[model samples]
Target chain A: MEEIKDTFLHPVVPLDFQNNYRVGAYLQRYLDGFKEKKILGAKCSQCGRVVVPPRKYCGACNLVMEEFTELPQEGTLENFTVGHVNLEKGQWKRADAPYVIGMVRLDGAANAMLARLNVSPADARAGMKVKAVWKDQVEGEHADLDCFEPA
Target chain B: MRNVGIIGIGYTPVFVSKRKDVSIVEMISEAVDAGLKNTGLAPEDIDAYVFGNMATFEGVNMPHLWATEHMHARGKPIMRFATGGTIGMAAFHGAYYHVASGMADIAMAVTYEKHSEGDAQVGLMGIITPELMAMLSAGIDVTGQSGMGAIGGGSAGGISFQASSYLHRSGAGIEHIDAIAAMERRNAAKNPYAHLKDPEATAEKIAQTPMVSWPIRFGHICPTTDGATVCILASEEKAAKIADKVAWVLGVANCASDATTANLIDSQITDPAEQLPAIMASKKACERAGIEDPKKEIDYVEIYNGFAHQTLMYLEKVGMCEVGEAHKLLEAGELEMNGRCPVNASGGVVSTNSIGTSALNRVTECALQIMGQAGEHQVEKEVHKAMAHGWGGLMQYCTITILGDKPKKL
Candidate 1:
């Protein structure tokens, strides 16, 4: 049998939506700390592991992390990636420049935070010391901690 | 628990990037029909239906509500699951439990994904988009900036970090990743149902493909295919009367780690490459299946490798080999279809991923191998037992199932 094509109708759909979300208390506190140039971490009373972008419950210890602690700005780069492309709302395009993104483990924290690294692809390496570069005028948002740079 | 076995399996006519000739419902009905045809069972024989897919990808939430009539599930209890990539196996396990617990005599697990219908990565962005928008509204300058959000690199960028970490810990190079990708592409060429087929694929050729991230090349990634997979599972009594051959369910297990595993920009409490959940889940499954030594007893493996490097990484994490031995196995051509323990004889998820069907394909492919029905892609060795793995939920959740030629001794 010969293959058939162009038998079905093609319809283009364009959907636009607006959504509202609650950042919750834990994240609210974390964002609030960003306004003061302070990085807030939730400390699990039982495990003593500090979690950044703090949440209410400790995933490991299964206990409430009511004690909020301030973390040092510097940490070690645990792992990272260098991407040559940008994904914008699911669309892919060539990046103007290759970018380095890393996961940084702050001092006294058991978990690491993910952030963009202001380092060249050739220079970024695991175990390198890095520090958070916060926005000068923070508006209590996620991007308040702009990115990380070599300490 | 009572014994349960896979009585039949069905796949869409083809697995490709588009199915423009048919509507979504029409495409899925084909797989349902195929299952009925293969098993020689009427729709009434199916006691229940377990459906799964990443609903957000197609802009269709709660698809089962609309798919009920098409699946011949009217008036039947239909359970739905959505756990990222693992939804396939998750749904299949749900069916297995339904039968093994004596609630249903027979059940059908159906999974599919129509990537051509909507933006695949866009659906994945739901996890971090709200926060990104909040950051944008607050005047945080992420525009044209690096690490804008988790969606910046989609899944590949973060996966590169995991790949690099795996290389660091395993002492394996990018060349090893290239070789494994070439191997799977070659394997896919033999799979009649696979989406990506490159029989002449080689490590050098794979290296020539453009890199998406530092260590991830376009050739190393999975294709966003449109397809569906269905497997009919039955209780021991029903299975005996339905088919001459069956793949018995020896054990099934799932493990979930903290969300921090996939945190690339946040503090990661656990390394993605460490894959503690895969280790825990596979070990628990092996224990339940009475498998003391996987390297010796398991005849082959079907790992949920959305990226080629995961095959080597998961082989180690699942304890099929020591922490650093999977690359050695690859170097020795031990992961080939003709090798001592064939891995991903179906070409694996790296070759064809419909997202929803990805994990379930692992189960169905292993069942096909055990039943000697895989045809061109079947391994040469005598198969007694095989393992199927699924990974989902920001790389922290994993499901493992052991399928064997014989039922577990109860």
Candidate 2:
């Protein structure tokens, strides 16, 4: 059907784009850590809040997360969900959508992270174990192994 | 919160074609002009403005000023807000605050998405990067939304997370999901102003359409609409001078959670869309309006159902029912226009929407119904009170507004 539609009308201008979603204003520290196959977290001295994936400040205390530390990419999976719907035009289908996306709590990390799971949503549970599959540094930033899979 | 009411509302029909009749600037003017006209007010009547189109799409660093200037409302207090799909209602809340706070006698909120200038899907996917394009695309055919301007991003980022939770927790099947898509498509057919108003829509047709992503068919997604919507909010004194009927903003609230942001490498970032912000807002608005149990007290609702999943989420978010019971509400037919509480009587954003403009359309439909002006979709019961919920930026930016027939002393 797309082929049929493309025959009569075609796009002339190049619609190519880029991945401009960066970590933060000074994203280098975060990007540099991920590039070295390590997870980073930020700690607030005033409130003693630990933030995973790190942050410039502790949201609660409204103060800077002064401590910078590398935490293990290991945490218990909290209340998990397997989303079956893959949206194109905001419609749902029986097939074609991506696998389940789950929330995970990293070891010693304050806030949980949301990403993809390699395991089937059906088999997924709240306490299931999972791990990140970081992309090869040579592949550059964001190309980091699409998402986390079963450990 | 002070009492605020929507005096007038106007939304342009979402068109598929690149309207050559008017420039983008003029297109926005048409909507703002109509909204002002509805209130019998001029440009100067508005003391402030809020524009809610994601900046990524406009390529305009400042959308608020552009819309304000186009509406001839420059030099007034203005704010520009963007949240993936929720910006429209988010901006609506911005203008609502001014009137509710006595800061302004009248205010206007304008939102538009002109995808004709570029590809919507590719533009939407600009959040990540080239090699990771396949991530957002996943296994779906995101063609229509490919170049559509990216608003507050939602299911676009996390595919299986929300849907899986909804189905798993509710014990719903693909048939139920298909039912949702069919219902909205059928509803859209009734809406002549809708983008894809095909009355012939059937579950088999939706099933046959190429599955863009799992559980989400082409019919389930919102149209890549190009249009604008403007809503004029006025204080009690000014509202009294407007049209015959005034839909008071009984309840209005906005809230957010801390753990919304996520690492691309991380899986399932808590799906913050589930936050009770919209419900909280509804409670606040209900308090001011003095109406309890919106299900029993309200007569009509226009929820943000950009995706069928959101309708489910919003049902719970607006406190219409218990969380995860949205699918059940659809199954029970509780959301039908004739049911206990009618929802999406205008066919909803799932049927006709320009994300930024869609939410205000919800507010407008309520005012029209209160004014007894809804041409075909008016409810049998006199619309004494109505509610409108708008979910912006991944459902992260939630705004709930309640409108009523009479102004109550708070």
Candidate 3:
């Protein structure tokens, strides 16, 4: 039997999709808090646990979180990763430099928030005190809170 | 419920980075034919079919519709399932249900992934694209430092957090991850179908690989491959009549947690390493299988480890060992093919990952071990019972299947 060489074909079918989503009432209130530089967290009625970016339901207690509380900007870094690459549209590319992405447990909030740690990778450590850095001019947006820095 | 047994198992000739000679449906047909041939049962013997794949990876929606004839399910009842990386096991569960429900005496589960046909990372990114787009529209700079931090490194990024948390909680070091990666790669060298085989692999060699994140190295990642798997299942009566050796499906269970547990931007209330769902699913499945102590009765384990640390992480989560004992077990050489509780003798998903076939391969590998059909990768010990685990969906979903050498007595 004669061996057959593999052939290839490349066809481009561009599929560009745009979808709309409703942020819901709880997240709406949470995002709105950014305008005032207030970090709002929803307090679960059953467990009394607070989560930042206030969600409506608590997964652990299986209860609604109707009460909102303002969390202090300062928190303790609970865990972090020093990333050396960036995923651009799902492709891996070398980052300009290594950066720390920290999991910070803000004061008064039971859950930890993920954000860029504005410190050298070597300086980032668990249990280190940090504070939220707000944009120079605040707009009601997710990025308005910027990154977290050493307090 | 009727007892179901896996009577036949089939795989594509090779699982590699690319299959340039075959098209998507063509590759799937090979596995289907292999299953039929292995069972000595024609398409007529199969009363139903369950098909699955991550459709987005191939940019082909409703692929089952296209693969109907190729899979020999033109007129039979067929159902499709897709659940991130667990689609393979999810489809297997669907086929098991068909037989257990008394709906069909024999059923076939087919799963495949031709990642070479399309972009896998893009498909993985699609899972969170809606949320990412919503954030972008809400004035979030996805390209900015904070935004990149938020996205992390896509799947690898989110996984790094889970890996780091697992390291912290388990008190294991990066070297353990390197060792497990090397061990599995060396195991892969024995399996002809495995994609990444390295007989000379060592922890030192793996550690030399560049770091993608703090704990996740490039060597720790699973390669996207092109392959298909087919499993034929039958009722107890049919299994006894057709196959001399059968791996009985003793129990199947799955558990799902809140997706927000690993939702990076929303803040995680539960630690990613705290896989309560895996524990719950394993406990339930083991109880149903009459396995009171998995550490003793379970002879083999095939864990869905897309990364090396996950093998240790899930081993602890699934109650195979104590909280921080998996790495200790690794150091004791208890996880090798010749060890007391051998794991991933077929090299595991970390060695060869065709996403859709990855989880199903776990189950099939276990079945092969149970049937004493696993050739080069077979463990030295006699296998009586084995556990197969599948995990996917933002790290929240877990599916477990317990298999035994003989059918459970009613």
DockQ for each candidate? 0.01, 0.02, 0.01
- A76-124 in candidate 3: lDDT tens per residue? 9999999999999999999999999989999988889999999999888
Report lDDT (CA) for all predictions.
0.85, 0.66, 0.86
- Once fitted onto the true fold, the runs of candidate 2 whose alpha carbons sit more than 4 angstroms away are A1-151, B126-157, B259-273, B323-325
Q: Evaluate residue B146 in candidate 2 and report its C-alpha lDDT on the 0 to 100 scale.
A: 40
Q: In order of the candidates, what TM-score does chain B achieve? A: 0.95, 0.85, 0.95
What is the C-alpha lDDT profile of model 1 across B66-92, one tens digit per residue?
667667787899999998999999999
Candidate 1 chain A, run of 10 with poorest lDDT: A8-17
The regions of model 3 sitting more than 4 angstroms off are A1-151, B129-143, B150-152, B261-268
* Candidate 2 residue lDDT tens string, B116-212: 6545555544433321333233432223344322212324434434555566665666666666667767666666556766667666676776555
Model 3 chain B: weakest 10-residue lDDT segment is: B260-269
TM-score of model number 2: 0.65
Error of 3 at A132 (Å): 70
Better DockQ candidate (2, 3): 2
Who wins the lDDT comparison? 3
Per-residue lDDT of candidate 2, residues A1-151 (tens digit): 4455543212222356533322343234555676677777777788676777665545355344557888777776776666666666888765565477778888777788887777776677888777877765533365563576666
